[model samples]
Target: MSDNSRLLRRLFDERVRDLGLTAAQARLLLSLDHFPDQNQCFHADRLEIEPITLTRIADRMEEAGWLERRSDPADRRARILHLTGKSRDIVDKLQSTVEHLFEDTLRGLSATERDTLGKLLDRIGENLARAREQEPVHG
Candidate 1:
């Protein structure tokens, strides 16, 4: 699974390089598009990355006019992340690229195989989440 993830990430990076984005940057944009108006901390957790790391990627993105971090109305200290018009325009292209990548990757798999694979992956995710919840706090 790790090998497959690395290969898919490499392919995605190659595809997005033409759009002037790194894999991390592209992922941030895609995540925001799908789950819009979330704060930076939410995005960090969703991406399974450190908050500082997300902030760095977001800083670059913000400078590139891809997104904005506006102060949350409900919480003066929290900054809500939002995709800019420029990023929104590119999201459709990015999403299509992802769809094409998945289509190519699953080309030889039969419908049943694909369904089984999906279910198995979902189970793995659930198991991992359950294990995480059961673990003792490090502190």
Candidate 2:
């Protein structure tokens, strides 16, 4: 899985280089695009990254004018994330690149095979989540 992830990242990076985005940055932007109303902490949880790391990324992206952070009206302590015009301009192209990559990667798989693989991966993910939940905490 790690190998596959690395390969996909490599391909993604190659494709998005013209947009001046690293794979991680692109992922962050994509996440914000999908869940515009969420705060940075929520995004960190969804991205499975440490909050500080996501904050750092958010800092850089904000500096670059790719996104903005606004205080949530319902929760003053939380900040909602939104894409900037620059990010909005490129998001559709980024999504297209990702879809193309997926299609290329799954080119030879039959529909049934792809469906089976998806189900198996989902089950594996559930098992991993269960294992993590059952793990004993260390102090």
Candidate 3:
């Protein structure tokens, strides 16, 4: 599964190379699209990334005009994320590129096989989630 994920990410990175976004950056943009107006901390938690890392990515994207950071009205110390028109314009293309990649990746798989694979992957994800939940938290 890990190998497959790496391959898929590689393919995605290749496809979006002309768009000037790394796979991780594209994913961050997509996630922010879904949950707009959330602060950097919110995005870092959602992406399971270090806050400083997300902040750096946000900084680059902001400079590129792909996104903007706005002061949160409720929390002056917090900055909310918002996608810019530049990113919005390319989102559909990005999504289509991923869809095409999936189609190519699963070209030989039958519907039943795809369904089984999806179910198995879901179960594995749930198992991992459970294991993580059982781990002790460190400050």
Leading candidate by TM-score: 1
Q: Which stretches of candidate 3 lie over 4 Å from their true place?
A: 137-139
lDDT of 1 by residue, 55-137 (tens): 99999889989999999888888899999998887888899899999999999999999999999999999999999999999
Model 1 misplaced regions, further than 4 Å: none
Better of 1 and 2 by lDDT: 1
Give the clash count for model 1.
0
User: How do the predictions measure up, each by TM-score?
Assistant: 0.91, 0.89, 0.87
Among all candidates shown, the one with the greatest lDDT: 1
Cand. 2 TM to true fold: 0.89
Cα miss at 35, model 2 (Å)?
Answer: 1.5
* Candidate 3: tens digits of C-alpha lDDT, residues 1-139: 7899889988888988877788768888888878888999999998889999999999998999999999999999999999998888788888788789989999999999999988998999999999999999999
- Which ten residues in a row are the worst by lDDT in model 2? 16-25
For candidate 1, the per-residue lDDT at 98 reads: 93
lDDT: which is higher, 2 or 3?
2
Error of 3 at 91 (Å): 1.1
